[model samples]
Target: MKPKTSALTIAAIAIVLSYLLILAIQQYPTIYRRHVDPNSETEKLPYQTYLATFLLFTFDELVKGNFTGTILKLKELNQTYVPTSLKYIFERFRQLLNELTLKLDDTDSQLDYAEHLIYSGREDDAINPLKVAGYNLAESNITYSQLKSSAEEFTKSFMLPRTQFFQKIDSIQNLIENMYIRLQALLERIEFQKNLEETYLEIQVYPENVWVGSTITVEGKLYTRTQPLTQKNVILYFDGQKISETRTSSNGLFNYTIKVPYTYKPKANIIAKYLPVEDDSNKYKPTTSNTVQISLLYITPKVEAKVLGKPLPGKHFTLEGKVYAERILPYNQIKVSWLTSSITTQLENGTFKLTLKVPETISDGKYILKAEAPPSKIFAPTSTTLYVNVQRIPINLTL
Candidate 1:
C-alpha cells in the first residue's frame, strides 16, 4: 500500500514540473507568432508562447518561491533579463490593457478590440492589424496614385486582422489559452518606461493663433503622447494664468472650447498642461503645451478648386478642393465644395491635404467642372474639363 501511494505521488509531481519546465523553455529567447524568416515584421512579439513562459516564470519566482532557478534558467537562454522581469510586470500590463479595452466603448466599432484585450497577453500587441497595415501603407514612401491599388497587397505581410479583425483577436486569445496556465503565469512582470525627455516624436499646432470668445480647437496630436496617458490630469491656460483643468482618457487627447475671458483679450495666449506621471517625484512638474497666439485680426481666405486623377469610362471624376485663405476673418470659417464639380474636398481647417479615390458612378465621356469660389466668397472661381477615353480599355480603377 505504501509503495503504490509513493508511485502515484511521484507521477503527479513529474507531470506538474514537466509542464512548468516546458513553459519556461518555450519563452527562452523570444516567442514569435510569425516565423523568423525574411520579408516580414519580426519585431512583433510572439504573444502565446511569451505569455506561457511569463506565467511559468512568475509562478516559480513568486508562488513557488524559487527566484534563483528562474534567474539562472532565463539567463542561460538569453543575455537579456527583460523576459524574466516580465514575470513581475504581468499584472500591470493586464491593467493597462483592461483600460485599453474600455476605449472600445468610445467607438462603436471596437468591440472586437475589447475582446482581444480580455484575453490579451503583454506580448500580443497586434490587436488591430488593419490599423497597423493602414498606418504602414500610409507612412510608406509610395505616392497616392500607387496607394489606391498596390498598397492593399502588403496588408497581410504584417500581423493583425486584415478583414476579420475581431477574429484575429479571438485567434490570438485562443492560441494563448491553449496553454492557459503558462500564459497566466507569464504576465507577472510587464513594465513600460516613457522617457519624455527629448522625445524623438513631435507635436505641432497650426496657425499658432487664437481669438477670444472664439471656437479655438487645440488641434495637434490627440494620440501624440505615450501610453498610460489616459486618465492623466490636465490643465489649460493663457499667459501663465490657469484657465481650465481636465482629465484625458481613451484617446489621450484634448480638443475643447475655451471661452476666452474678457479680462485678458489683448493678444491672448493658449497653453495646455498635463501631469504625465504622478508616481515619480518629478511628476507634479506639468509639461507646458505648445504655445499659440490668439489674435482678433486673422481672416480665413478662399481656396482654388481643381480636378483630380484621370477620369475613366463609367467612373466619376474626383476633384480636389483647396482653401488658400491666408488671412481668415475672425470667427469666420470655410467649408467644402460638396455641391460643385470639385475633385478634392478640403477640410474645414483649410489644410486640404487629402488623397481620395474616385468611384465608378459617372457615365463615360468628357466632364466639365467649375472649380472656383464666387465673388461673394473670399475665393475666386475657376472651371476645367476632363476627357476620358474609354474606347481603348475597360474601366480599371486599380490602374
Candidate 2:
C-alpha cells in the first residue's frame, strides 16, 4: 500500500508542475506586451480593449496599494495618450473651428464697414455691406436671429431717421437754391418792365435819301410816363459808332446836324440812345431807342464808253462801258440811251455792253455818240459822249 500511495503522489505532483509551466508559458507574451512603449498605436485601442487594459492596470495598482499612482496612470492613458485616428479627428475639428472663426471675422469686418458708412451719413452706400452680412449670416453655423435682430434695432433706431433727416436737408437746400434763382429772375423781369414803362424815346432824321458827304438833321424827343424828359442827354450812333450828342430842350425835342461820311453801303443804321442824368435815386436805368434805318443814296455815277471791234462807217460796232458809283449800288436797273433812240441792255457786274449801227446816210464828219444812264434811285444820272469821224466813200456806186 505504501508503494501505491507513493506512485499516486508522484503523479499528482508531476501533473501539478506541468500545469504551472504551461500557465507560465502562456503569460510570457502578455507580460512582454505590457512592458512595451506606452504611446504606441496598439496602446490606443478600441473602447472595450482600453477598458480591459485599464481594469488590469487598476488591479495591479491596488495589489501594490498605489491608489494615487493608479489614478494618475488612468488619467494619463485616458486623457493624455491619444490614438492617431482620434488625433486626426480632433485636428479636423480644430480646422473646422478655425474656419468658422475666420468666417465670423469676415462677417464682423463687413459689419464694421456697414456700421462706419451708416455713422458717416452714407446710408445709401451701406446696401452692399448689409447684403453681404445677411448672406454670411445665413452661411454661418451661428443663430441668425440674434445678429439680425441687432441690425434691425440699429436701423430702426438710427439709420432710417438719420437718412430721412439728411434727405430732408438736401431737399431744403435745393429748394433754397431754386428760390434764389427764381427771385433773381423776378427782379430782372421787374427791372425790365419798369424800364419799359418809365422811359420813352423817339427819333426821326430828315432827308432820308441824302447823298454821301451831305448834311443830315437828326431830331428826337425824350419823354417819361407823365412829363417831357428835359435837359437829358441824347446821343446818336451811326453804324455802331457814336456820332453826335445833345441835350433835350424844354419841349423834350433835340436836334443835331452831322455831315454824312463816305460809305459803300446803300443803307445806314442809325440809333439814338438816351442816358439819364445821374441821381442819388437808382430808379431810372439807361435806355436805348429803337433802330431807324435810312436809305443812303450815292452820288452821280460816271460813265465811260468806247467803240469796240472797229468803228467803221455803215458797220455794226460794240459799245461797251463801265458805270461805277461812288458807293456800292444796284446796277441791274440802269438805263442806257444813245441820242434820241434808247436800247435796253443788261448790266453784268456794274458793266454794260451794247451793239450800235452807224447811220449810212450821215455825212462824213465829226459826229457825237453819247451814252446816258438814268438814275437808279440810289445813283444820279450820268452821260458820256464820244466823237467819231467817218470817211466818205470815194467810189459812189449807189442806185
* Top lDDT prediction, candidate number: 2
Tell me the whole-model lDDT of each prediction, alpha carbons only. 0.41, 0.60
337 in model 1: Cα distance from truth in Å?
A: 56
TM-score, structure 2 vs. true: 0.30
Per-residue lDDT of model 2, residues 41-123, tens digit only: 24333354454355345435523434356445544544534456455443342233233334444555666676544422234
Misplaced by over 4 Å in model 1 are 1-211, 220-228, 263-266, 280-285, 297-399
TM-score (all chains, Cα) for each model: 0.22, 0.30
lDDT for 129 (candidate 2): 68
How many pairs of residues in model 2 come into backbone collision? 0
